[model samples]
Target: MSVPATPMERSVPRDARTSTARMLMICAWLSLAIVVVLSLSIGATGITLAALPDAIQHWLAGSDDDATAARHSLVLLEIRLPRTLLGLFVGAALAVAGAMMQGLFRNPLADPGLIGVSSGAALAAVATIALGNEFAAPWIGTFGPYALPISAFFGGVITTWMLVAVAGRHGQLMIGTLLLAGIAIGALAGAMSGLIAYVSDDRELRDLTLWTLGSLSGASWPKVIAVTPFAILIAFAIPRLIRGLNGFLLGEAEAFHLGINVEATKKFVVVTTAACVGAAVAVAGVIGFIGIVVPHFVRLIAGPDHRIVLPASALVGGTLMVFADILARMLVRPAELPIGIVMAAIGAPVFLHLVLKRGIGGVE
Candidate 1:
């Protein structure tokens, strides 16, 4: 390093990096488009691939006078559209949050829902459902349909704050202790949900169990509208923090030496992760492992840079969830399997293989 090359030359990696990034972007978009086509075409009613765009156009135009137009519009807008959008947003949010959690803890195995946030949200939702039963108590029965999600959001936020507080010391955070504390809190929340289920009447118990298992069956335009802001905000915010996250890979002291505001970055990650994952859990119940599995898969293909990994994860996660949702719908024909169960079933084998192949630290 006789001359210590110019800043631009040192900072930018030249054409190879640019070309690889462009190729990854192209592949991600192609994957997303394929997933969308599969989501629209594979349902029980069976809309043809050719007719799908026309159906979407007519629905958008609001000109549904003909029987075919009305049927197509009804299926596309009312059923498939909401479900597809929910899968997309929820997948993106969960994957982004998972990536942030892994970066924050410097651990490849870290996942958003591994913390208490999702479990806490689920427990709160179950409580709200149980309490809102008209037969249970007149005072609690006043809660409306929206109460459960609101309760879940609040539960997630509170639990996340508690985790942060417990894991922080003198402006420093301990990742190991944080993860352990999350496990402890998650166990407590799970037990509380079980107790609530045991005490509830039969109808409420059934509802509680269904909520715990998780489904995108409750997806609707209103739910999408409610979750969109948080999901989009976090999705956009995460990529901007990529440089900071990259610094974190060098450890806190080296990161700080590189001009990263380590504490602020950590806090931002924690809050953003909480907001995104909380919103997903609030709307989708306890869907799991997309965060853990999708980001790592993307990382394997895209490399360790958060710049590529985060966006790639978002696209792959959305595609995976949309396909999984399709499988959930068709798995039992008229009756639906829980999306959470489907994700866990797929994710577990993949996770085990990763552990065996790369150990807990993941691929370099």
Candidate 2:
């Protein structure tokens, strides 16, 4: 026979858990800072942190009078900084997106790719690569570097809209229908993307291959700027959904009774998640597992509270990406491995461990 817990016993654990969660939140932010610095410092060119200050000062001085300093500064300002920032943004967006999806679906294993968003983005990106010279020329001319990302973003958006349309009944979103529809649509999108890749010329095929594997080699100031708004959009929207998300953990009916607009919250989550994942995929290609792994790790340290889980996931996600990018650059030295490959190698093992130890419903 089991003994019942006293109120004091329960209250003490709650206080201790809250304290531990807060401490982990701070630790997450600090880890992000450390990784950002490391990302800016360690690379093929090997810009030491000690020289980073001097490099920045020279880069801002607007004169290449000192050839050595100019080279270091150029590498620092032009290459590493933008790449670091992109990692942070993409990491945060993808991880937070995973957190939101997990909360919405009430499943610890959920990810944005479950709903065809990544597939749609990939299909559109691949299509642009194959057909850019003919069909996408006008878009290329008009948008310049923005064209591919823009296409991918819209592809994700259209996929989400379709998911909503197919899964909604009487103004209520059915989770069972959504999951089934997502799997079917996602498979279709993947098939189409494969078909496009199969017929592409050598150059386009190479580009498609590199992109589908994912890389930050194309990181630039414009790409960073493009993804910033979406990152900010996710950040701004998270606080409003915190209560609803926490209530959602108790089931949709309980959330509705707590005065949460269950339907509205569902719509908001799907929209924001799509936009976040879309923009991340747009700039960085199809980097995976940051979404799934980061949130689960955060929950392990910080507990399952969305208040801590969401923001902490963003911080930890960005940190993980920056670190992964570092390894990608250093592992092969000059030739650079794709960031996605590094992520998969690292994330797959961790995810497997989590599953074995905690099981699927272990977020609590």
Candidate 3:
């Protein structure tokens, strides 16, 4: 007879894990810096690198009175700043949510959008619009600014909770079952959204349709401010989940044996995912595949550890969205294409390649 190893003995390999963690941190920081610089530099109105900092300073100081200074400030602060920051926050939030969903389900292809959260949020938003109450309610209209994002966030939370309750049992999420349930829920939401669209006036219908396609063109300071708190809160919460996510890789029973509270971890993962994805959808509509694409690429470079994977996904996701936004702005020049279309255009082919190269089950 042989004695079982102690919990500490069965833990992740320390030396290799530490090395991987360091590499991921380096890559994440570098990528984040590059994206920020690139986002600030490029836009519809040209702003040279040398003048960028001055524009930012003038905007911050509320002293941009000169024509050149005012134009640059408008470009940086009003247009590029909100859009880029929203993209950064939305991208980071979606990627982290995707990372958590993958870890929770132990399925590499899992994404919050695919699981009906985005659709759910979109449905709710479209419903609000159809009701002619996009900003008419006293509390929301009084605030005047935060109404859309606030409504969208609540829509995401409610839909995600419904999905979880419908799909889960005693805190256990069965991957195949969950996917099927998500498909069903998404279809239902999509159908209802269509029904709402059919009965609505042309203008409302068009607005709702455009909203579903996703665009950062609507980016504004208020939306950026609205998404910031939830995004930061969720992103901050993700690091604390590193250990539990790592535990998930070793199988549920093994994780439980290692002192992980599996049920609580699952619940936390679900709530965090909903919160993050909901905020993104509220702000950006349904920009797809950032969640699915970014985490896999991060794992390919940084390995499968959640600690590294989560942060690296955020960095990579932000960069990808910023670039995609650039392309969206430029692709139709003077007429913006939806960011969702741009992401799907890029993401679909790459996703197919990853699927073929790794096979469905092989991605993990």
Candidate 4:
């Protein structure tokens, strides 16, 4: 009884752009939720999603006196849950940081690592892990778990500001200039980290290696609590940069004429990106490419609108990281692979393809 002429109607769409972005964003959030659940369920000691509810119920009710309940609680609450939470937060931070960096420089290749922020932060953390025990005991004791994060945060903020100062001219940041400066600074930070590694004892070397390679194996509730603020900052505060970031898609002159605070925007982005990257490094070591990969992928699906790009990047970034962490665990069985290696395996090739196809200039 249906009309045969409905082929034309099916081909026509109304405001598909809005609908598409909305759907993408929805799917992104759903993907994050599903990934988090799966992350909890798939480790060496498995906890299936179907079993999660009863586990939570017994855990909450404190009726978990039985050995099986105790085992589930130990696995879920003590080990898997913290890492899963850490992965979620760190992933979101890295992704948002990458998106913000790209938008700030108006170059798709602009990443947190490129700016020397991650290297500088990692250097600080490595120094703390390698030598702070002997030299800075008082401060470390006072700050406790916060000492490393605080040092890394300061290091990141300082490095990022130095880059901004060097690259910013009359409120305009030239992409090429910043990229060159970032390379120089990042190399210097890497050298310092290497020096620290050279002087480190076997124990210190092990710690440094893990920090650089990146892992959630060290995930603990305190570390989760440590990173929560930066995570919230990324999740909520960074979206405010969308308007200014959009303005920068045009020239800085154009953005200024449009009443955007070009200088302040540059500073805001550099500082926030530095802090976010620093916190992430302190918690998970040098996990790379989340920022670059997630945002670019989001842009492909959602167009270049910073508004859609930022939040979507955060969601997708978190989800992608969860999956990566899962793979890192499973790839080596009882032994875990570093998260950085997983990310590099994926990101390095994507970066190479972009360079080959788009060339360096086309990234802008």
**Per-residue alpha-carbon lDDT of model 1 for 55-140, expressed as tens digits?**
77787788857678778777877878888999998888889889888888777878887888888888878888886555435534
- The TM-score values for the models, in the order shown, are 0.88, 0.94, 0.86, 0.88
What order do you get sorting by lDDT, best first?
A: 2, 4, 1, 3
Error of 2 at 279 (Å): 0.3
Alpha carbon deviation, residue 161, candidate 1 (Å): 1.9
Enumerate clash totals for all models, in the order shown: 0, 0, 0, 0
Q: Show the lowest summed lDDT stretch of 10 residues, model 3.
A: 132-141
lDDT against the true structure, per candidate, is 0.82, 0.88, 0.81, 0.84
What tens-digit string does per-residue lDDT give for candidate 4 at 151-172?
8777787888888789888876
lDDT of 3 by residue, 1-364 (tens): 8776875676658756677778877877787788777777776666755677778787777874677877888887788889999988888888888988888778887888777878888887887778746445774666455666677788888887787788788767655666778778888888998999998998897778678988888888988877777877876787788999999888778789999988788778878888888889888888888998889877765678887888788888887888888888887777888898999999999878877887653553
TM-score of 3: 0.86
**Candidate number achieving the greatest TM-score relative to the actual structure:** 2
Question: If ranked by TM-score, best first, what sequence of candidates would result?
Answer: 2, 1, 4, 3
**Under the 3 Å rule for N, CA and C atoms, how many clashes does model 1 have?**
0
Candidate 1 has a TM-score of: 0.88
TM-score of 2: 0.94
Model 1: runs farther than 4 Å from truth? 1-21, 49-65, 134-143, 170-172, 358-364
